[model samples]
Target chain A: MRELIAIEYAKLKKFHALKIIFAVYMLTVPGWMYFMNFFFQMEPGMKALFTSDNPFDFPHIWSYITYSASFFNVLLAVIIVVVTTNDFQYKTMRQNIIDGMSKQKVILSKFILVFFLSTIATLYTGLVGLVIGLIESTSYDWYQNIHLIVLYFIQTLGYFSFAFLFAIIVKRPAIAIVSFILYFPVETIIGKIMNADAYQVFPLKVFADLTPIPFFKSIVVSMKDQGGKTPWILDTNIQIILSLIYVLLFFLLSYYLLKKKDL
Target chain B: MQQEIVLEVKNLVKNFKKVQAVKSINLNLHKGEVLGLLGPNGSGKTTTLAMLLGILHPTSGSFSWFNNGTKDENRKRIGSLLETPNFYPYLNAYDNLKVVGIIKNVANLQERIDSVLELVDLKERGKRPFRTYSLGMKQRLAVASALLSDPEVLVLDEPTNGLDPQGIAEMRQLIIDIAKEGKTIILASHILAEVQVICSHIVILREGEMVYNGSMNSLLNQEQAFRLSATNMEQLEQALHAISGISITERTETDLLVTCSEKIDGSSINKRLVEQGIYLSELHAYQKNLETIFLEKLTQ
Candidate 1:
């Protein structure tokens, strides 16, 4: 397992696509945070902008940072798809297998790399959020906020894992990215057209549910005015459990296909 | 026989939908021997190699390596280059080798990587991305990767497929050196001359079946020997028919070739022709080259 991890790390380092995605993340996250902090001040009337008890508080800074960095997470998911699928596209998987590594180990390495990268992004977001929040206001509840920030990191991982599974199953970066793009809007339109409460149980809905804010309430006024009356399909615990199931199921399916594949 | 054999495939079979790529093929390689696997396109050479390396599963039958262990564990003692070298295009040779080293679980990986690069004569270009490499360079790197682990067995499929004449010669020498170092090699190629020059034994496959397998010398020895040329072609033919132990197998404008069942010197044939009053122009011993033998087998 250790050797497999080392191999995957070397592969991730050698892959330009991963490096470019990471570079973009590093540059854009800090740049966007600083831009928001120094250049664009939030107007007093903007309710969406958290002012008092802002989730983007110090020591809990990652919470706000991750919220703002979600876009980049989506991009990272696409990159993961590309990295995994290229092995198939270029027929390198056959070479790798012949070189001595097992199919299980190869798929595990990809999962490990994705998990590690998502963790880093989540922590980076959290830390930046805390620092920027402290700079904004020092009197915030740094201790309680730090706890929430940790929860946010976990939630981010859960969501990222779900996206990673999609990438794995689809095995094409472009298709995965397009599917990710259409995910939320399609879920929204379908949920409205069907007016089915059960639609909220979808994977995307589970992801939205894990966020600090509720999904339906944020989108529709009727759902919001109901004031928690809408069905709470899954709390954080259920979301985490389902996300893990998604990871296991997709990883197993991917492994089976890879093992049996003709290359 | 068991002690000398390095690899054995028994009744191995593989199919792709309606096409049978390998049909009940069996092969064996001995230590310090280069076995040339000769076949045309889609003749199952590559497929056989793939199955040997555990990249492609056989539809039936079984193959074992070293005769004692599982395929994956035994694979550690074997190295193969079945097709084009595939690497992270963005990475330099050194980094690409580093990744392979890690996956292969080699000790002293850096030193191993350096040594392999040197062995393939790609040390100077080791730091360049694979995308920048020429075709021959890529092949050398592939060879280097196969050599990295210093396995006892090396399997290569068309190792010099796209190389220039000079590159092919260099590769041929390299393969020879590897074989001399006591490594068992299975080299698959369509170039009969290359195989004839480097391989001690040969296996010829046609339409997913083994058409021939034996030593190079034995395969050549099986061909008939006797060439006849005469000034009077009609008299030469009549005299050749009257002679015992000599049977005409081929006829051309300039010569009539016969296969002699027993060893007979050119002088004896000349005496017999002279006694028959048939003037002989040329009489020489016939020896079949690898190309001729291969063409004969293919046609057969």
Candidate 2:
């Protein structure tokens, strides 16, 4: 497994396009945070929201930045698609098997890349959140709600695992990327049509629920003049568990398909 | 009393939907023997190699390397180049070889990569990306990749596919040198002459079926053909008919190609014709080549 992961790194580390895309992903998350911070600070009327705390306060900022950073998980997901499909596009996965790696290992290598990318992205987002919350917020309490970092990692795995599945199924890089991106809206439309209980277990819904829009819940509560749970919203624990299931299911399906198909 | 078996395939079959690509291919390749896999287009040559390499799953059948079942670990012992040189187009030769090294778990990867690039005569351009390579250079890099692990078995399909004449000669010589080192090589090529020189055994496939399988010497040592023509054509033909074990197989534009069962020299045939009051002008020995035997197998 260590060798397989090393092989994946050797194949991808020098890849300029992949590096550029990854750099963009890492930068865009913090860049978007800074942009959002600027937009929020420019406005004075928004201070009323956190119920009793401002959005940038240390504890609130943890959830706020994590919620904001999770949206960019799609970039890491795209990276997954590109990395996996490049093997197919270049016919290198077949070569890897020919060179002595197992077909299962071929798929496992990409899964390693998926996990590796998600871990780095999560760590980068966490570090950026910590730095920004430290500099922007005036609170000595750094550990408050910091467990969102773990949630960020799981959210990345959710998006990236789905992207890994799409890459294996689609093969062609362009087609895989386009379809992977397009599936969000397609699932959104499908999720809207499903009943409330069924929609709670849907893949995209569960992954999205990992980091709900930070202040949106409070804003909705203020608007409603009453505090109540929506029928479609799943408990974060349930969402995390379901997302882990989807990750396992997607990778297993990918392994099965790769074994069955002729490279 | 028997040499080790490098590879054995039994009733190997592959189907693409309704179409069968390889039909029950059965052959045994012993150690230190160069096996030439010959077939025309779409004869499942590539498909067979693919199955053995584990890139394409066989529908039903089995093949083993070094008498071991198709284990993933055994594949690392065999280096193979299937179809084209599969590499990251964005990576240079050194980096490309590094990927192969990692896959095969080659120790001292940097040194191995350098040695292979040097062997392929691409040392100067080792850092150049694969996309910028010419067809010949790309093919050479593939050969380098296949040899990087110093595998016990080398499976090369069209190793000299896009090389220039000199490059082909060099590549063929490299294969010969490698074969001389007692490595088992399974070569699939359209260049029959090249196979005739390097391979010790041959397998011919026609339309997804094995038409011929045996030693190269056994296949080539079947008959001796001589293009004999004389000044008195009628007397020459009659004399050839009178000689036992000599049958005229075809009449070319200027000579009668007589297939001789026994190994008779050109001088002997000339002397025999002269004894019949026939003056000989042409008595050229036409050696049986792989091309002739391959075509015969295919047509059969």
Candidate 3:
């Protein structure tokens, strides 16, 4: 296990795009949150409207930050797609196997990298949530609703797992990236044509709903009292379980593709 | 004493949909034997090696290393470079080798990496990224990586495919030096001369089939043809024809060319001519080189 991590680190430690994309992501996650905080404070009418919502409040701050940061998981997914497809593009996976890495280890190396990246992303999200909440909230319990950070990690794994699948299937960085990027909008369209309840159980829907829009559910609940037909999403715990299942499914499919692959 | 069989391939086969890439290739590579795999273009030489290295799934067959099945740990004992120099283009030679060292689980990998870099003469340029390397440098880095583990058997496919004349010579010498360590090596190449110079045994493939497999000496050990001159050429020609195993192929004013079976040598023919009261002034033994034999094998 140490050897696999060391090998992956040696391979990507100098990757410029990995560094740049991650830097951009790290900066934007907290930077965007701070920008929004200032934007809301400067607008009087908007402040009056959102005064009741208070996205940056202590307990609610966890949801606000996680929901906002979940979108940037695409950047992490792009990193996964680029790094995984790089093995195919340069044919290094074939070389590594020839050099004595088993097919299982090759897939496991990617999993290690995914786990590492998710941990980094989660910690940053948690730290940003803590600092932002401490600054904005007047009084609160420290660990109130902090489980969202853990769910956010699961969501990150779900996104990266699908990215790995696309890379393994497509075998080209550009095509894999484009396919992964297009999947969300495309699934949304497909879900629209299909039954609303069926789409709720879809992988993207489940992962996305893990950290659902912070105050929007309450707004929808109020709207539902007035006979609004907004589609109902699964509970957070169910979504987490489904996301874990999808993560496992994607990893297994990736392994199957590699085990049967000629490369 | 018989050497241990290091790698045993039992009728390994591979098929790509409608096209069969390899067809039941069976051979035993004993320890310390330098085996050369020779073939023309599209002859499945690379495919056979890839299967042994687990890069390709053999359609229906098996192979063993060191009298054991090919397990994950056993793979670390074999070093292979197939078809091309594959590395991360953005990584330097040292970093590229570090990945291989970790995969091979070599002890004291830093020192091993340095030693291999020195062996390939890339120690000076080890820090340059692979993308900035010349073809020969990239190829040398590949050799270094393959040697990083100092495996029991080394498998190389066309190690000098795109090298210059000097680079080719250097690469050939490198392979020869490694073989001198009494290590088992399986080299696949199109250069027959290269094989003739380095390989102790040879295997020729054509259209995914094994056409010829034998020791280099057995294949090239014959006295194919000879030129002889005698004081009385007429008498020498008659006496040569009298020998049961040889035939006079060419007759000229000054000499006669005799094509003979492997049993016939210059002394036997000389004795026959002298017995018939003819004295020979000149006798030259001419042997057929590998290219002609290889072509003949392919055509056959």
Candidate 4:
């Protein structure tokens, strides 16, 4: 396992596109967070629209960090697609098997890659969160805020595992990335027909609800106050458990696809 | 010498959609023998190798490696280069081989990589990314990876597919050297001459069917035929009747093809024809090589 991870890391380092995508995610996240934070404080219209205490305050700091970094997961997912598709495109996966690694080891190597990437993303988000929170928040509760780090890791894992599945099933990077990017709107359209509680069970929605925007939670609470039924998405633990299941399902399906593949 | 069976494939078949890519091919690879698989395009050579390496699932039947051990354990003892060199294009040959070494769990990683690099004659260019390599260099690197583990058996598919004349000669010699090291080798090629020079045993596949499988000597050492012509047709006819174990397989207006058993000597037949007063002409021996036999089998 350690050897496989080292090999994967070496390959990833040499892959220019993946490195570029990762650099984009790393450089863009903090700048994007800073820009959003600056706008909410400086722009009167933005301030009126947001209508909240300093969004970067102690309790809100976790949500701010995770929410701001959440959309960047799409780019990271694209990186995953590129990395996985490189092996397929070059037929290196088949070579790996020929070189004596079993099919399970091939899939396990990619899973380890996903775990590594997700861990890095989680640590980066944690670092960004700490800096921003110390700067903006008057009080700090490390235990409360650090839970968001775990959720962030799971969310990244969910996204990357889905990308891995897409790359395996699709086998073409461009098509896989386009399809993954399009899945959100398609799922949203499907979500509307299902009851709100049932829609929360969807994979991406489960991940999204993990670090629900701080303002969105306030709106949901007020809606409940106005006699709105509390959607199942309000239960973070259910979403986490369901997300875990989906993560496993995606990985298992990816494994099955690779194990049964001809190449 | 008793040769141990290293690979046993029983009724192996592979079908892709409606096309039967590999018909039931049954073969056993013995230890330290170089086996060549000969066929034209779409003859299921690659498919057969893929199935053995577990890259493709066989549609029917089964194959076992190294005394029928589990695949994981068996694969560790085998090194293969199937169809193409599958490596990261961006990585140098050394790094690509390091990945192979890691996968195969080779000890003294850098030392083995250096030795294999030297073995392939790519020590100088091992630092260049694989994409920069010419086709011959790419091929040599693939061979290098297959040899990385010092595996018991080597499965190579068209290892010389894209080499120049000199490159092909070098590759042939390399294969010969590897075979000398007592490693079982399964080589697939359309180049009949390459197989003839490098392989001790041969399997011929045509349209996904095993038309021929046996020793190379058996494939090439069949009864030979000679084309005979004479100035006196009448005397030639009479003289031909005097030779035993020589049958006329084909005849033209000016020539007759006389087939003889392997036990018959050309000089004896010549002496008999001379004794019968029918020798004032030409005699040409046509020994069958693998190309003729392969073409004949394909047509059949």
Q: Each candidate's TM vs. the true structure?
A: 0.88, 0.93, 0.92, 0.93
DockQ by candidate, in order? 0.59, 0.82, 0.77, 0.75
Compare the candidates by DockQ and give the number of the best one. 2
Write candidate 3's Cα lDDT for B1-300 as tens digits: 999999888889989988887888989889999999988878899989888988888998899988878876777898888888999999999889888888888999999999989987899887988999888888888888889899999998888877889889989999999999999999998888989999999998998999888899888864478889988887777777777989876678998877888787889878877887888999999776788789878987
Q: Write the per-residue lDDT of candidate 2 for residues B1-300, one digit (tens) a residue.
A: 688998989999999987899999999998899999999989999999999988888999999988889999899998888899999998899888988888888998888878888888999986889999999999999999999999999999999999999999999999999999999999999999999999999999998999889999989877788898877777789998887778897886688988887667677777777787888887888877789868867776
- In model 1, where do residues sit more than 4 Å from their true spots? A30-43, A48-66, A145-176, A179-197, A212-231, B68-70, B238-253, B259-279
Model 4: pairs clashing at backbone N, Cα or C within 3 Å? none
Chain B in candidate 4 has what TM-score? 0.87
lDDT by residue for model 1 (A90-163), tens: 56667788888777777888778767876787677666666667677556766654554444555555556556
TM-score of chain A of 4: 0.93
**Candidates sorted on lDDT, descending:** 3, 2, 4, 1
What CAPRI class is candidate 1?
medium
Docking quality class, candidate 4: medium
What is the descending DockQ order?
A: 2, 3, 4, 1
In order, candidate lDDTs are 0.74, 0.86, 0.88, 0.85
Residue A183 lDDT in candidate 2: 94
**In CAPRI terms, where does candidate 3 land?**
medium
Clashing pairs in 2: none
